[model samples]
Target: MASPVDTPRNSPSPSPEPDNPYPVETVLTVPKFKRGWAKGARMAFFEARVPDYTSARAKGPAQTADYLVAVSNAYCQQFTWWLDPPNEPTASDLAKTDDELDPAELQLKAAKILRLRRASRNLLDRLSNSAPAISKMTPAQIKRDPVSSLISAIANGKTHVPRARTAYQLWSKSQFNKDIKTDVDQSVIDNGVDAKSGRIRLVTGSTQQAFQNLPASERRVWELQADAEKAANQEARGLQKKDGVIPAMPLDPTATQDMLDALVHKIDPLLQGISKLTNGNAHFYWAGPEPRRGGQINVISMHAGVDRMPIPCGFMEAGGSEGVARRRTVEAAIGDFALSCYDPKVQAARTLPKIAPCSAPPSFLRYRPTTWDAGNTESPSAHSQPSTDNGLISPPDVSLPGNPTTSSNQSPSATTSKKSSKKRKSNTDAAAPPAKRHATGVRTNTNDEDQTSDDEPEETPWQVDDDGSGEDEPANSQPRRSGTRTSMRISTKTLPPQHDPLDDITNTVHMSSSDKLPSPEIPDNVAGAQLTDDDTMNEGLDTLNAPTTPATASTPVSTAPFLSNPTIPADLPKYLTHVLPKFETLAEPAWQDVTKSFVKYEVSRKFDDVRLQTGNRPAAAVQWSRLRRPLITPDKLPREMPQTVKLAAEAFWRWWRHLQPSWRNVNASANALGDIDRNITEEDWERLDASGANGLVNVMGYLWLWGMKVGVSGEGCQDWEAALRDVQWALEKMTAATNV
Candidate 1:
């Protein structure tokens, strides 16, 4: 229970009263919250239910981010159960946290909002490109299947995919267009758009680079393209003289980048529905640097549960000299067919149980140290873990009900479970999968080692070091990171020295060039090299066809273990894999109702008298047999399954009602209250009957399944590229099929 102080706290303030009163002025002084006020406000502005995203704007000599100002004032005082101490960045803090800003600082909510916005713009741009070239095209063309349109565009070398575009474009492209002053989208191709005589036209050689795949040069090109596009758009409008033809304008390559992130904000609701559908919330996160790297794009789409963790469904790389060239393709490449949006595969249950790593450029794995808790402990800076296995490294269920300590043998052992259930009858089989992907949003294709190799040194195009000499570092001294912005530097050895001697990377013998000096002696004990010949031979064997290992391994392992990726790979850029996933994790809570429910549950029942008077059952117990169904008999109990089994199965609901002790008096007081209507979605009740691991998995599964139904879904397997097409198809088909 934290209370605020009237005095502004520059450092640690005196502890507040236990009342944890939501004091207006004093609570705002909490140091932990001070840092994130602006960011939180921005998130809340969009997250809070509203008539529209923006508030009414008023003219002002001094403009401010209304959202940020509110957050700084509201959450500034005490630390909430869900929020860690404040790390809010102020204008001055931004100057201090310039280059060294930790990527982790840009939490999930912020990241997701960014992803949503970026993705929306990117999707629109794509649709703009593939729209009917002639504004007055036939209805058939205007209403062509979006997924098919995207596929056709991809197959026919069209510049972009067709997703949901503006209604103006849709109507104008249709034969019905007459006097509507619809503007053509120059960022994307003007497919069926009638060549507006007064508009400017621009040429753009676009590429779909993976969020993590683009080189720095390519990323910069993307940024420049975005800025230039903005400039072009501004100039185009102004170019309209009394009677001139449309100005010729080049397209903005940046407009279609993988920055496909969520522009909208989603806030967690207290006592809100848990395990809601996942569709309308699919978002793409672009990892940010410490100093406010950038925004993410979001969407709602169906995805293979745990399996989706292994595939970067929206990844692509192209046309950049450095950094990442491609922007995230939100729902593209999945062949987003309208009907396919209802694909049975989209309904399957799959959850990695936790945030997992994206298996992209090998370097991204570094952020997820082998220990799931490494660098994530209460005292993150104090813990320095030794790097061990490259294979998945699961952790003890630290977030479980009990204080799951770092020590292992005393962890969630099978022995404790048997002892706890000794008095009760129990039997079980909760199978586990072979390996789990990390919470990070990266996945390397086991079948596509060549994908990593395609951009290798041999086929390499432009050199970051324009001079033939690969010495990219400045002749004088390397530039120090000022804040979040740092110039790109291509490492000489893009791939880690960890390639197996027998794998595709095994072509170890390199021709020593007279121009290039030898690198330092390769360490014999390098992790990749430490493996035995047998291990090297089986290089990708662990991921390619790893057998599913049952979770019933006597001890429950936290599913999303971090990988210790050591260095950046030349072929892969750091931004895509190295930094993006953290943003996703921060955003996860908003997309769902985890934290809010837990916080609310903590404060519930503890003092609520209604709960005391009426325990779990109603005052009078109605025969469950007559009301619902008869309980399983003792004989059947042995065979009956459990809906949920705890691994790290730890969380909560409304606290004010649940924890507080209630009065036993039969007569109710006027002040007596009951926290009713704990949101029970269809997904919830169905999971109620499920026991053990099935419960958690199925709950998450239904959420995702429903999500796809609402967001990204199509009939069959949606490859990364075609998914967006399906989304467009779904939106359009649904829109057209509507009687409106």
Candidate 2:
């Protein structure tokens, strides 16, 4: 997904709209930052409605050059300031601003702004004059050109271009390789192989073999050293460490001349792949400082094609953990983007399949019984039996609601006999104990013989009893006649109720007495078989009228109102306790006044500390005495203020009250009545003289009190308490200071 920062709010159209009066005016908006510019820029340049190459070419070289210069200037202005403002400019000073400013500062700022414009013009002229030759030249030819590199740096912030020569230098001078050479030379010397006497060859014969057969412990040490070196190298390359593992280089070989040559050979194909993907319009370059941290290689476009603005295609990390699973390079990142554009199947293959909200019904519900055997017309037994295939009671054969019986399945006489059989079976089941009743199947009773009687109306299957049981048999239900065959048949359409209707019917049967039948055990596999039509209809109605759960004590609630208990803390100072409850209902304007007064009180305290440290120096003593009056006058305060400021003010009051005894003791020592002031240092006095002590103390006290009230703990509360302690210690030390 693309972020809002990367997408352009408004894009330009190639041709004017039918209602638009002007046709030539075209406007494009680009983001000021480059963090999410890759994906956004690609959408703006390629996906947006813009003119084709033929239309752009018709504008001619002169118009194109002017457009390039305008875009380049706009890009440069975001990061660069063209003019320096004069310092301390008054009405009179503004008239002579040039004379007041340093000449060197003016020249440096002007040169940078002009440099970008000049390079852009130079690039246009170079391309226009050598159009045919430039078209034939490879990507290497354009990259090596000075103009291409200069414009790329200005437009897309591409600073570093990787080279095979640089890679070779990095490997040759690496500390790990130097250590390996040292170990090989030391091994040869320890083995009594005299190289100076020419007794044994040192370069490749015995010494090389000894280096290859290094011990397991020594090899492990080298591997650890290599990992450390790789981490440091990646840090220098501006890549972040992932999962505590530094990204590995494309080719990492042990310290050997042969391995080093192979490492250089592997890099050539990677560089070529990057060049081929970008062609000549853009270059794959590292976009950051020379020794930058936390950055990646980006494919920066030069705006040489149909694109009006210089945009990056995408970026990729330089290295990953060494092995079969290496991180993607710049070539792969660009290739993926290109393939997604050309191949529709690639995107289709990556998309996840959609899933249904609810799962399919169980296999038992899908079971449809075959037609009954006509040759042997034996009636079903007294109770319905469970099917061997699935652990569910076989449903009785009956016509479903809104579904008429077909001639092929039922004859006129056969239909009447089935209805009579169901009516008799329902009465027998109702009289039987609930323990014997099957809980997984729904039973429906129908009687055509009862329909003719006007006095007792025929009962419908949808009717519910007075006790809310839908299983109540008709009031005129009859017992089964002897030798009557009852063929049990289940309708494949309707499902059973969630709670057994038989339980409710059994409870209705014994309503007068407290005794009830025990529920029959159901098989674990067919537990869901009891979801009948009546339960489903009731559930649908309940869903429409269901009430939502209300908020409970365990749920998190907002504390924005700043309401708290009326009772004040016992440790709180008596002078401020009366005003503590007012903070809960404080207004915004009065809270600002309290903050200002607290700042003044803190400033006054600093001056008083300076007076004690200077041994009653007249200048310091006068300043302290002047500012001491009206320092947080409690009676003059407003009726209400913010709770945070109130807590902070109260803390300052308590802290001052606590320091009173120490202040008196320090004052006595300074008057030559004690030796406490003798231990004070000049550094302690200097620290006390620093400003902003008032704001620091106020903030720390507020945080400490707020954390306690809100039940904040862990490192967060500990940090605030630690800061408060440091402030208290500093103030105590200031009180004990003597003349310097």
Candidate 3:
């Protein structure tokens, strides 16, 4: 017998039919191997099953094409099985009877086996059709057979699963926000895989440019399609979105090659600016969907450290209707600012230097209000004892060495007597228990109201100035003696010297170790006198002194003042800096204006409102004129109105009036224009009413134009111009509708 490859070209076989031309089971010979067969025997068995396609080639080109198609289909079926193999039943599964097993499980198992059988038949069919399975064919065998070589190339080539149909359907349903069925059908034709060549058809430059000129909704369709495509491809390859291996956004037709390259160049500078503003605590990068490649500029923040993680900031798309991109950019910047406030690293960076200074007490030592000040002045003994106010313990009559009460003019005998008397009083106070002192309040008057009235003094409490400037004293020099004995003032006998007492205390407390002061003798009657050490007392006093130098020299006096500052960072992109300020002071109100404008434009443009046409005075315009009469007139514009806003409003009015020649009389009432018969469906009316008012759109439209004018300049100006042109085109369409 001749070898399979050397078989005669005209050998008799079943005639080929138009459909199901190649009978796979009849023509193919399955490879059979015994359990004990060696590797060589198995290899020879597979070689013997290889197909002879010489007979089909001898018939005609038509027959040959049919045969190739059948062979390709068979190979695909076999490859499917190789990708996912069927699971064999285990011993435990075999032990279960039909009744014991779940019907669903049994059905699933049978289905899997059926697929495996089909795969086996196809595997044999490929061998009969001059092509062995890819796994069985050697490199040398593949090169010898053209059919096998083609199959090998196809199997090994990059796998591009045609996901455009799935992607387009999902994208349209979620984001298209228009006639879903119509747009989906259109997208399949425009961006889907070519039927002839199983590959995505490249969009031509002219088609792309035309798409850029389309309406905002239509443009968004293409942009979303590109994003879906990239996401699908990434998922197929098990690639992460942040791998930075982003696919090019071919469907964003507005962003040309030059524009995309410019955006790429801008990334480093933009990120650098953000990093500088955040003090290296935050990092920005392009990521998400097709935004990384200029479909939309998604600026994501990552914590700037070893374990960097993605943070949801905001995104800006390059193309949209007028003011859309600018609005999105400003919103994104604001979102980043807000999110950064809660970020641990960001907050730490902002406050690290100020922590110690802000937390430390004020530099000047002064008396603060205590618990006794809250109308609880009733204790006599508590008032006479050394007060623990502000954590300082000093006897009532104990005066500093330099104080006038302890002046050098006093005789030594008199000073000794005063000191002896002070020691005796201290011993008596120490002998008294704390509980007795707290209980010894003036309870003679039991009436609650009388006690409150007597205790609550009309005059401010007396405060002694530690610096001896007497600035803390009340206007009346003579101290007011209140009926309540528990006044907040220190005894007059223990007045501080005419200088900063803290200075002397700090010197005495922080004295050199070698300069040991003599310890004073304690009386026998004083409790805990033996436990008190002068060194320990001095150490405790040291803590009372305020820090001479702040913990951080560079610490700001105020904390997080940026939270209140209206000014934006100068290092930010010029577009952001220019546009952000306009919305900064009136962000919420401006956003409301933008939303109203969008609704008004959509309603008027869709319904073809004749009142908004160039020749007719719109109701919005008349209302605007009436409203502006007081704030703006021929003589002067309101001072509160910005120059930019005034100029923008004026320019928009001039452009609106002259947009088209006015055949109608200038004196025609806006009410007359509204009276024109027009077919508006119930749904359309609902949509129109849902839009609320129209005047704000006209106001915001002018402001948006002014912002776009100033925000973008140079080469970057083209994008904004294209956006404005879209708005102009929509308005022109509305105008043409009226003429019709």
Candidate 4:
């Protein structure tokens, strides 16, 4: 219901009143917006007509927002999903105002930059057409927010990722080299090296002396690693040498802030593309010592999944204290990566699934102890074996000459009575093996036991004693060579109680006067104790086998002592009827050296034994000679060896001269000596592979023999003696072609 005054007021136009009224309220009709008006058919037609206008509207701040969401989310995922918090930059890292950075923090920044680079690239690629507004955004600007700041607190941290990695690698590598160099120094220090040359000295003469000496493996590995580290260090040193690049050593902990900053600035871009293939997850480490016992800390995305644990790479012998020694011992015990997968036996018998080619080796394919979580205990140290020091075995007394003959009954000093005492003194002074012979070059034989003898006490020509009763001769005195020979007390055994020579002579006279001393006892203990009945008969049968020593200085001695097993027995004439015409050839000094060396080494004794065992076959005699040569000639003796001892030296010389071409390639030329009944076939060669064939064995044997003949003997070459001792080792590993 309308009021009367209101009724008139209610009309479309209202009138004014004297006291209380105003003008009329108007209602105007306005054009309406259509349903879905902003997105209407007319607007759609306009948008379609002008594609650029629609495109401009679509590419607005909303695209920027989407990009921020995508890039931010990607980086966040990278940080949260990939890196555990411990590996991330911490409050301490953010507080580090100095240019000097914690390696971990630098690593974190590098990882973050990697994430940003990856995310930004991905975003730019995806938003190329519709989200052109994304071009306005940069990871540099976006990383400043609290969320992005969690990954990298410092501004421009994203830019440093690559350089940080390179610097880190360089720093770590430099440190590794330093440690390795220290280890090398320690090795040389603990195990003394030669003063004149740098080769390791033989400190002990145990049967297993090879282990006591610098192990060949350790030497080889250290040499290689040291060379590499030295090269890298030199390169870094070269870089540091650059003017204004660094004010001090690059590795100095307190290097100038500017230098450090410059370093970071210089290095960042170089490593930017390091893991482009692996998405920044392809990192390596070289860790050791406390906190990094498993080796240098690093993270890499392994094939199975992400890895964030310390990885053990190669074993490094700290070679330091008990603790360090324990660590090295442990590393050696369980850490050597013997790739069993490649072994034929293991491959044939394995029940496990095959390893993936893309994944890590078996040594690194297992889970490692992680440092990220709390309550994790450090790995326990390995239990160490008890150690002891035995008398340090060195080479057999090099100061004294070996017995001239294998006959233990005869004193070698007696034979040298006429020689100048100066010759003996010269020989004694030159005790050490000559440098040319002591070369520690690699050899085919690696077995340690055979390198030196511990089985029997070495047979010395005579024992030295300082019984005060016997007056010592002055250094310049014309001392008997025999008396001087026993003056060097080489063995560690305590000397027997001193005796008065007058008392001994009086006692000897009393004993001799009381009873004729039991027909000059022929003790069985002496070498060449007595000629066996068979040996005597053999000698008597070969009446022309006796050796004749020439008076020339080149002759080893004026006469070959009656060593029991001489190739030409004492009773046998030197000129054999089998080859009597060749007797003139035996006059050479080379033959004298060969004959003396053979007698000294007891080779003729061994030759007779082999000849008897292998049958009276003349071919067997030649085979025995081949076997004996290497045994006798590790340090090649000055003389050339005769082909066989069964024949007279002249006869063998004649045969050797005739058969030079046939025996040139020792292995290829000689027929198989031991087990070969037929010619080797192609299949035998294939099966043998690099293990060595009949020909190889023969050639090595021949060369070994030749080396003994020509290699410097006496104290001139210790390596030769070592080689001689290793004959059994060679025979064990490289036997005659058998089971063919």
Clashes of each: 173, 11, 2, 25
After superposition, candidate 3 runs with Cα above 4 Å error: 1-299, 302-706, 710-740
RMSD of 3: 35.1
Comparing 2 and 3 on TM-score, the stronger one: 2
Candidate lDDT values, in order: 0.23, 0.27, 0.29, 0.25
Best-fitting candidate, measured by lDDT? 3
Ranking of models by lDDT = 3, 2, 4, 1
TM-score of each: 0.19, 0.17, 0.14, 0.14
Off by over 4 Å in 1: 1-74, 78-234, 239-661, 664-740
**Residue 662 alpha-carbon offset, candidate 3, angstroms:** 20
lDDT of 3 by residue, 65-169 (tens): 434443333333223211222222345543455456566543443333334334433444444343223444455644554453443322221122334444334
Q: Candidate 2 vs candidate 3: which has greater lDDT? A: 3
Q: How do the residues 345-464 of candidate 1 rate in per-residue lDDT, one tens digit apiece?
A: 322211112323222111112112122232224334313221111111112222111112223321111112212211221122225322222211111112112112222333221112
- When 2 and 4 are scored with TM-score, the better candidate is 2
lDDT of 4 by residue, 622-687 (tens): 332322111221322212243332222222222222222222222211122221312222223221
lDDT: worst 10-residue window of model 1: 526-535
Error of 2 at 178 (Å): 11
